[model samples]
Target: MDWPAVAAAAAAGLAPTTPIAVTLANRVIACSAAARAAGVRRGLRRREAQARCPEVHVVTADPARDARHFETVIAAVDALIPRAEVLRPGLLVLAVRGAARYFGSEQAAAERLVDAVAAAGAECQVGIADQLPTAVFAARAGRIVEPGADALFLSNLSIRQLSTEPSLAPPSRENLADLLWRMGIRKIGQFAELPRSDVASRFGADGVAAHRFACGEPGRGPSGRDPDGELDAVMNCDPPIDRVDAAAFAGRSLASTLHRSLEAAGVGCTRLAIHAITANGQELERVWRCAEPLTEDATADRVRWQLDGWLNRRNAQDRPDGPITVLRLRPVEVVSAEALQLPLWGGIGEEDRLRARRALVRVQGLLGPDAVRVPVLSGGRGPAERITFAALGDELVPQANPDQPWPGRLPEPSPTVLLDDPVELFDADGNPVRVTTRGLFSTDPFRLDAPGRSGRLSWWAGPWPVDERWWDPALKSGRTARVQVLLGPDPAQALLLCYRQRRWYLEGAYE
Candidate 1:
């Protein structure tokens, strides 16, 4: 039942100051205007950013909160536009051509959208273009491209914009942009001029997609695919399910069935549409747009997030009045599967992963979701922070990262034993060891007095500083200090220690 679990948790750590930097995997992804003025930039690690500007507040990323709060924005948009395709929580794509006509002009429609969202307490920009990619770039620059100038608008832009949409672009696009930069093809126009055949032969499928986007063409290209008849997975919820917990279980099973159908057909889903019917007969549907094919877990995540948002809506008009009686997942867009190169000898674990997943699901069914959990690696600056637990059948999504690195993190040989409570650390005088407000250790630790963990320290390591979330009062823990100590015979056993406000406590133990 313990499941050796880890839950996905990301919390920002730093002083509560105006110049703030939000980090994931220890690298900066966003910063406040104040931080930017002080020389902090995206991709700068906390160590370097601190050197550049010492007053900046560094925070870790929290994906759940981002998605949870974004639902209100999505609801605001849904009120105006029925099905604006959500690419991620903050970004969306909708065919504004019709809205432009209805509003009398494209500019007018955009203004209306901005006002609607602003009413919901968020700022936004709109872009008009002949193609999706062009529109995406136009939105970034807060400009409306001319009726047929999608190509021209994107031509002069830098190649770095190739990965403009993080939720949509493949990782290779970023690498491709770097490759082009090194080859002297600095502008998108230059890359767009390459021969299609050459791009296909050299850059492969992803390259072809990028070329098409830069040329003001659609990204799907000529796959000429079909989801066939079995692509839609529907479930008739007999007793009805309105609670988030029930929805989570349904999402897991439905996601697996949908993927099995896609896998059997040698295709993958690109866009997913979730439709639900409540007991009151109210019908609801939302479409999700993705840059690439949706993996089973990705599909499940979207399902869970969407349903959770709908069920938890604070607005009376937005929340469902009754339990859901019918639920269906339809793949609105599909593409042919491409052969993937494996690691040659290490690709066999996929079957094992799937088998383990099934066993966990069976356990979940027998004992309930919370009883079966699994450990997940998440972004953080501390040992316990790196690990999180998720219900077995749910998607294991890690928060805060396109990559994982923690600067100020302790070196490896992680603790094999985690302590539930902090143990007291003592000096030779029987007085508790302490840390000063200036982050200085009061004195060297001498005796350990933690019941069975008691011992005399032979050697010790730091009083390393850890400060997180001072800005948010509900989540802030003032600056804390940590140290490593060898205890018992030869100080044979090792222990991790934490100090806060005149108290010392055991954190963990090493083998």
Candidate 2:
């Protein structure tokens, strides 16, 4: 609103010579007069601010803190006005009709608002008008115009202020004002005089609302409360955290926020979104989903997992110097409160599946999200083509029975040891004879090797040469090697292995 008042208030929180400024990461969100006079303006980078105002006091914008502080100020106002809606951080909207009647005038209510914010350790400029946007601009402009004179008051103001929607667009406030000047709408009053149909056809709905706002007409009803209101809360840091540890600490705060919100709403959340704001004005957003509704511990675990995920995804070339300043956690989907239902007879393995899912998530946190997977049967004849890694909790399509049994398919009970990249092996004699490229290998009758002695290869099996998917390039051109092996008990009653890659390696035993 009033740049001077905002500057003064912001400066009051800093050293006298400190050029106070607010930034959302690297971009300046707001700046004091002293800072501006030194050439520091909103949207300037932190480096640019330092270059312009060497003594600038930079404070990262903390929307949650501002929101909390605003809530306290509004609570005080509610003590007097009873009903109020917080439109944004540092902005409050109230029905002044009742408050004005009680306080004897709208000016009195405005004064009270300013006084209340001041008492709450904040200096705010209050604006009183019929339209919310007009009042907002009046507040920012640092003026309190009479209720009935809003049109006259807005007429002289730049049209840019009418189009201000902080949460939506990125155009500079001054640029919007300049555009209005070029459009020959020098004042809010002139813009308001334009036909609504013409305004809507040209500038869209936002423009129409701005026009009505300039006319001093109430553009809309009070801001509606978001249905997922319990998902909101603020994190306050002592001495202002500015390190990586601060982000970790903020994660705890986010967990607490979610816990409180969910407790109040009597529900649990299935998904949470964390928004981290850095001192340099950068925002990192991450979303976490749980297979089951989460508890407080689970929520924290998810947050930690998300942070790790972010670190893994970022390039080593660029990393933040300081810790995150603020972390906002919002639960996007809240599930109804329900107890875990256990089957009386336990016919299906649902409990085991749930446990497996949790274990997979834990492993993912330790190894990396993509490092672990469950093998699912995909409809195909070849071994490599039939098996696919599935993410935890994903539904699996059953493998179809081939029109004819795969002639070379391995016998029941697949090998227990499965390596991602299997090594090649050779026979004891160092001969090149081994398993076929298609998982078929001819082995001479062999006996198992024992600690005391070695036996001969006995009861050799398949030399079944099976051709795999020759059509698919990804598999055919690369991993199309076939394999053949012999299965028999060794002298020690343990199964021994030999394969084609010009060497002998233990594949596995057949129990």
Candidate 3:
């Protein structure tokens, strides 16, 4: 919550003293201390927040921005304790036993951890308990309980804490706590004293978990699954792989190794992790999830696609600095192959998908990744803007969500052809046709003049004018006026022309 407001203010170059609020869906989700002082609070409507704090600076809540800026905080904690599990942007949990032992005491470790984060420019509180849930609550209260006192410290707390405390458990358990409250078990002590068998019989596994937490049992916290007995495929790229083809070639064998291992274990993966490390020590990881368990070819294809995306970034600056030095494929989630029931119909079988994958891989190898791209229809005002490109095996996500209303965006019957470059429009006298700031045509277009073709204009429609981001000069793309015109001596060809920066250019063509 604090991270969102701090990130927003930081982006706007506002000091920590500034009254700021971050809103999502027009409701205030996070507010700075100054904003709170001014009466702006969470859950308030944007207008209400502004009404309460007239000087408040409101920003749209961007989870991406929050996470990006919160990396500093994570880095700070990780410096002392590697691999801390981040529960949320601001909440992190880990077993600090080793750190405490090294520092000679838990409180000293907590103090140093707090100081480390403070040095990183964010204030943090630390808590230590025998169990995770109690430690989470203790952290919230900004206290460190002595060892073996987890139950005693939590006994008097309201039962709602189980539901409200984020690190303790999920909200489903909160519903159980609410039900317990209705039954007059209003404190953790009461819930802890309930018979484990009775709780399991009445409320089930979630209730049992809740009971464990309330009893201060060292419940399973995400220490990551037992890796000692786990099978993972790892390969070192000795000379390093800088090209997509090489990476794809290497990924195939590695995927085969992983599948063979899984096959021997009689299981198949539904969710798999692709982990790569650059020669420069930069780590890249992505998770691929499938409806059905992944086969050998399916796993290889996913790895290849992921490698292609990493290597074939359109923007050169976004590309990795060096070749990948290592690659790993780990099955994070799996189920027995026999447990999966194939659909009766209407789905492509594994063999068919594998064949399609091989065909795409061949095309990607023969032609470079960029040369073979899949077109995805995206939301945009113009025909040229609506089409986006992704690498052959890459996933396609819209440039902008089509569901959102885009004012002033052009309606379609989209044009059949989009010109690579705009063409000039001229009058019958061969004088340049122009558009005024008021959207009026200086002279009617009577002829179309492009590099290889010229023709007399037969008819035309529209001088549709659009002004985008006029309020912010930095983002403004300049004003543009468009027209649809037919030009030819015999059979006229219809064209879309746009006038901008004192020149007319061909935008698209109709069939």
Candidate 4:
């Protein structure tokens, strides 16, 4: 999450001390320290955050953007520690036993690791505890507990810590903690002090497991499974393929090979890294995380996604100067296949989702990336401004923060068909019905003539005034007013019309 702040700071040439918030789905997901100081916090609505910090830079939370910037930090940590589990783009955890032993003490190891991350242009906190959860909480507080003090350090923590402390907490643990809190068990110590057998009988296996963590008992970490060794599939580009189709073809084969090998070994990866090297030595890499164990098609889809994100640039400047020379898929974190629980009932089954994804990939290959775009909600008063298209495989971030109060947005029952070319609107005299400079209608819209039908207006809704970006010269599209009108008498059809530049046009249809 900090990566978003870090990325925004770097991109905008602003100091890391500047207040910033990365918004996703119209809520604050991550905020910089300066923003937090200004009363901005996680989960706050965007408008509330803006009210608190008017100068705060609001950015869209793009996981790909975060991961792309985070790769340097990973490389830096890997230089110090051979392998570290990247729990997410920003959060990472690695066993410090070896590093501490080599450095002669845990404190010394933590300092060196922190300094390493600092050198990579990121501020990081390192903490050491016998257990992973305790270590993570300690790291957030910038503290390290003594080797045997893990349980003691966690005992006094509030039950709410179960939800907030960890990057990802099991839903069961969160629910159990809430239940315990209602029963007056507010601290971790209280829960831990309960008889283990009783807790198990009351809350089942998840409760017992939470109890163990609460007592500072060492739980199995990522190292428990031990990495299966360089289980990555690599594809070499002999002539340096530039077209997305060719690169995707190679990715499909490599993805198949990688997944087949993992399935044969009876394990599956939860997080996989897609690494690519351009002909000019520019390194492009991304990590794709999955909720369920990745199947062959799932793996291939990710490969295509990462590839599309890199190769399909919206502008010339965004595109790499050289073609990709090498592409690699490395399993960064693996889980037992049995750990994934397949849902029995849902909207669409896994097979259907996979098929849909494959179809999207095929379209991207055939029509180019920009042709198959996905809509991301953004802040704007106008219909067109409210949604921006993101290229397929691009980590979708809003173009505008949706939580902002758009003064003149169209009301509910949005138009379904947005016309590419607006049909001209006219009056009974065949003269264009115009909007005046004072935001008033010059004449009533009496007749409607278009491609398919010609009829008198049956009914009409008011011309809602909309004036956007009136000051910014580059974006000033001038003032316009919209009206929802019923075109025909029998089972009247709805049409959204806009008036600007002394002319009226059909903008969309409610059908």
Tell me the alpha-carbon RMSD of every candidate: 7.5, 18.4, 9.2, 5.5
Give candidate 1's root-mean-square deviation (CA, Å): 7.5
- The TM-scores, one per candidate, come to 0.72, 0.42, 0.55, 0.77
Sort the candidates on TM-score, descending order. 4, 1, 3, 2
The residue ranges of model 2 lying beyond 4 angstroms of the native Cα positions read: 1-17, 37-39, 165-184, 223-511
Indicate the worst ten consecutive residues by lDDT in candidate 2.
393-402
In candidate 3, what are the lDDT values of residues 1-511, reduced to their tens digit? 4778987876677889999998765678889999999999888978799999999999877644554455566667777876565454566777887888899988888998899989877777787888777777898788988889998999999988877644345557768888998999889998899899999999987788788888888754535443332878999998899987779767876886887798789888866777799999898765555535776766777777667656764345556789999999988778886765547672558558656766766676667666677788766676766777877644464554455566666667777988856677877788888888888888877878787656888889888888775777775356877788887747778788887777777888888
**Which stretches of model 1 miss by more than 4 angstroms?**
1-22, 31-40, 44-60, 220-229, 339-349, 362-370, 376-511
lDDT of each: 0.75, 0.55, 0.75, 0.76
Model 3 — which ten-residue stretch has the worst lDDT?
220-229
lDDT of 1 by residue, 246-317 (tens): 887787778888988988888888888888899999987777878878888788888887888788765667
- Candidate ranking under lDDT, highest first, comes to 4, 3, 1, 2
Q: lDDT tens string, model 4, 271-384?
A: 777888889998765555543467676666667645655665434565666899988888877887676554667435755875676677677767876778889888776677
Note the clash tally of each candidate. 10, 41, 2, 0
Q: In model 4, how large is the Cα lDDT of residue 231? A: 84
Return model 2's CA RMSD, one decimal: 18.4
Candidate 1: what lDDT? Answer: 0.75
